[model samples]
Target: MLSALLVTGLAACATQATAPAVPGDTALGPVLVDAKRMTLYTFDRDNAMPGKSVCNGPCATNWPPLVANAGDMAKGDWTIITRDDGSKQWAYKGKPLYGWVKDTKPGETTGDGFLNGAWHVAKP
Candidate 1:
C-alpha cells in the first residue's frame, strides 16, 4: 500500500515563500508543492532517521531536500533537523520533505512509488 503523511494546517517549513516552499492542494491530491507548484516527495529511507534525511550527495542530486535557510525555525507542525553534514532541513511532524528530479513540471509526480516503492509523494 502507498503511505501518506496526513498533515493539516501545515506546521513549520516557512522559508517565506522563497523557492515556493509550501504545501498546495492540487489535482494529485493534498500533496506539498513549491512556489511554482512543483510536486514534492518524501523518501521512506529518510523515515529510518525519523525526522532527519539520508539522501545525500548523489541521492540528494536526484531528490533535493526541501531545504531551510540559515534562520528557518520550526513552527506549529514544521520542524528543522540537522543532517549528518550539519546542514539544516525542513521536516513536518518529524518527516523530511524532498523534491524529485524527474518531475519536470509543476504537479508532475514521477517519483511516486519510485525505487520499488521506497519513495512517495509527500502529503499534507
Candidate 2:
C-alpha cells in the first residue's frame, strides 16, 4: 500500500510538471506564459478575428509560437490554433501567441512593441 501511494504521488507530480502554464497577471499586465513563466507575445500581422497566424519560416525561428499539446482544450479567452506546419499553438482572444527567442528570463518584456510595433506582449 505504501509503495502504491508513492507511485501515485510521483504520477501526480509528473502531470503537474508537464501541464501548460495559463495566463496570469504580471507587472506587464495580464499575459500568457509558458511552464517556466516566460512572457508570451503576439504579432500584429496576424488577424485575431479569424484566428490566423502569419509568423512562419524565419519569422517563426525568431519568435517561436507557443505550442499547445493535442490534449489541450480551449478555456475562456484562451484557444488553440492550427499552424501552417500542422502543429497546434496557443492563442489569446483569437490572436496567436508566441515567445521571443531573445527573452531569456521570466517577466522580461524585451520583445514588447518591437519591429515598429509589429510585435507586442500578449495582454489581457
Candidate 3:
C-alpha cells in the first residue's frame, strides 16, 4: 500500500512539473511552441523578404508553414502567396513565410539567427 501511494505521488509531481503554456504577445498573436516537435510561429509574416522564404517540406513538417484562410482579410504587412498547390500562404513581400521548430514560447526568439544565414525572426 505504501509503495502504491509513493508511485501515485511521484506521478502527480511529474504532471505538475511540466512547463507552462507560452503566453501571447502584444505584437504577436498566438505563438505555438512544441519542444518535442520543435516548431514556432508568428502572428505575422515579418521575416519574408520581397520574394523569398527559407522553409519548405520536411522543414515545414518541423516548422509548419503559416497558411492563410480564403477570404482572410489582410492586416498590416501581411499578404498572401498562392502556392502551386493552389493554397494560399501568408507572406510579407513576394517571399513566403514560415515558423521555426526550436522556439518554445511566444516571447522566446530561439529560432532567431538559426542556421547561420538562413532562419530569422519575423519582424513586425
Candidate 4:
C-alpha cells in the first residue's frame, strides 16, 4: 500500500512538472514570462492579420520569440503561431511573443517601449 501511494504521488508530481508555464501579469502590467520569470515582448512591425511572425534572421537573433512545444496548448488569450521557419511560437492576443536578449533579469522592463515605441512588453 505504501509503495502504491508513493507511485501515485510521483506520477502527480511528474504531471505538474511537465505542465507549461502560462502568461501572467506582473507589477509592470500583464506580461508573458518563461519558467524563469523573464519578461516577454512583442514587435509592432509584425502583422496581426495572417497570424505570422515577421521578426526573423537578425531580428529573431536579437529578440527571440517565446517558442512553443508540441505539448503546449492555447488557452484564453494565449495562442500558438507558426513562424516562417515552420517552428511553433507562442502569441498573445494575436501578437507574436518574444524575449529581448538585453533583459538579463526577471521583471526587467528595459525592452518596453523600445525602438522608438516599436517594441513593447506583452500584456495580458
Candidate 5:
C-alpha cells in the first residue's frame, strides 16, 4: 500500500508536456477538443470535489471523460486527475473534461447548456 500511496502522491504533483488533447473551433469559441475535434465539456457537479470527476457509471456513458494515457502528466492549466476507478482523466484549471455522446460531429456544442445548465463546453 505504501507504493500505491507514493504513486498517487507523484501523480497528483507531477506535470509534463502539452495535453493529449487540443483546442478546436466550436460555435462556443475555442474549446478543448480531442484529436477527432469532438467538443469537450465540464460538469458543474464535478466542482463539488475539486480535481475529481463525479460523472461515472451511466453519467459517464453519456459524457465520456477525456481519459489520459499511461504516461500522461499535468502541465500548465492542465492537470491529470485520478478518477474514482483509479484511471487518469484530464482536468483543465481543476475541472474535469468530457466528451458528449450526443455530439456526433466535430465542433458540436450540443452538450453545452445541457442538464439544466450544469454542463458547459471546456474552454481554453
Candidate 6:
C-alpha cells in the first residue's frame, strides 16, 4: 500500500504540465530541479510584482516559469504572481525564477548564457 501511494503521488506530480515549486520549501539544494516534476525552485525574498518577468519571448521559451496556483502566497522568501496571460509563476527577491528547457537533467545549469550575462543559477 505504501508503494502504491507513493507511485500515485509521483504520478500526479508528473502529469502536471506546469508544476510550480511548493512555497516555503527549498528544492534539493542550491536550486535543484525535480526531474519527476519538471519544475525549478529558488530560495529568496520575492517582492510582490505582477506580469513583470525578466525572461520573455525567446527567453521564456527556454526558461519556463514554474506556474503557480490560486490561493498561493509568499512562503518565507517565495512569492506567487499572475502573469499577463493569467498564468501563475513563482518569484524570488522580486525576480522570477525559471527552468531552462535545454537543461535535460536535475543538475544541468545549461541556461547560463550571455544574455548580456544576466541569466544565472537560482540560488537560495
The residue-by-residue lDDT of candidate 6 on 3-118, one tens digit each, is 99999988765555433443222333456344343435322222233436645567568677876666555665666766667787877655677776776755555555435446
What does candidate 2's lDDT look like per residue over 11-116, in tens digits?
Answer: 8666544435566666778777887889889898897446878999999999998888766677777778898999998888788889999999888888998999
Clashing pairs in 4: none
Lowest summed lDDT window (length 10), candidate 3: 19-28
TM-score-sorted candidate list, best first: 5, 1, 2, 4, 6, 3
Q: What is the TM-score of each candidate against the true structure?
A: 0.78, 0.78, 0.51, 0.76, 0.84, 0.59
The 0-to-1 C-alpha lDDT of every candidate, in the order given, reads: 0.76, 0.82, 0.51, 0.80, 0.88, 0.57
- Supply the global lDDT for candidate 2: 0.82
In the range 6-124, model 3's lDDT, one tens digit per residue, is 99988766544443222244233444333333334432233443444445557666655666665554444556666545666766534455666555544666665555536654443
Better of 1 and 4 by lDDT: 4
Local lDDT at 124 for model 6: 49
The number of clashing residue pairs in each candidate reads: 4, 0, 6, 0, 0, 4
lDDT of 4 by residue, 1-124 (tens): 9999999988866644442345666678767787778888889888645588999999999899888877567766677889989999988778888888998988887888888998988765
lDDT of predicted model 5: 0.88
Question: Measured by C-alpha RMSD in angstroms, how accurate is candidate 3?
Answer: 11.8
> Given candidate 6, what's the lDDT at residue 32?
35
Candidate 1 is scored at a TM of: 0.78
Off by over 4 Å in 5: 1-16
Which sections of candidate 2 miss by over 4 Å? 1-20, 23-27
Regions of candidate 3 where Cα sits further than 4 Å from its true position: 1-54
Q: List the residue pairs that clash in candidate 6.
A: 45-93, 46-93, 68-88, 114-117
Q: Which stretches of candidate 4 lie above 4 Å from their native place? A: 1-27
| Order of quality (lDDT) | 5, 2, 4, 1, 6, 3
Error at 102, model 3, angstroms: 1.9
User: Between 3 and 5, whose lDDT is larger?
Assistant: 5
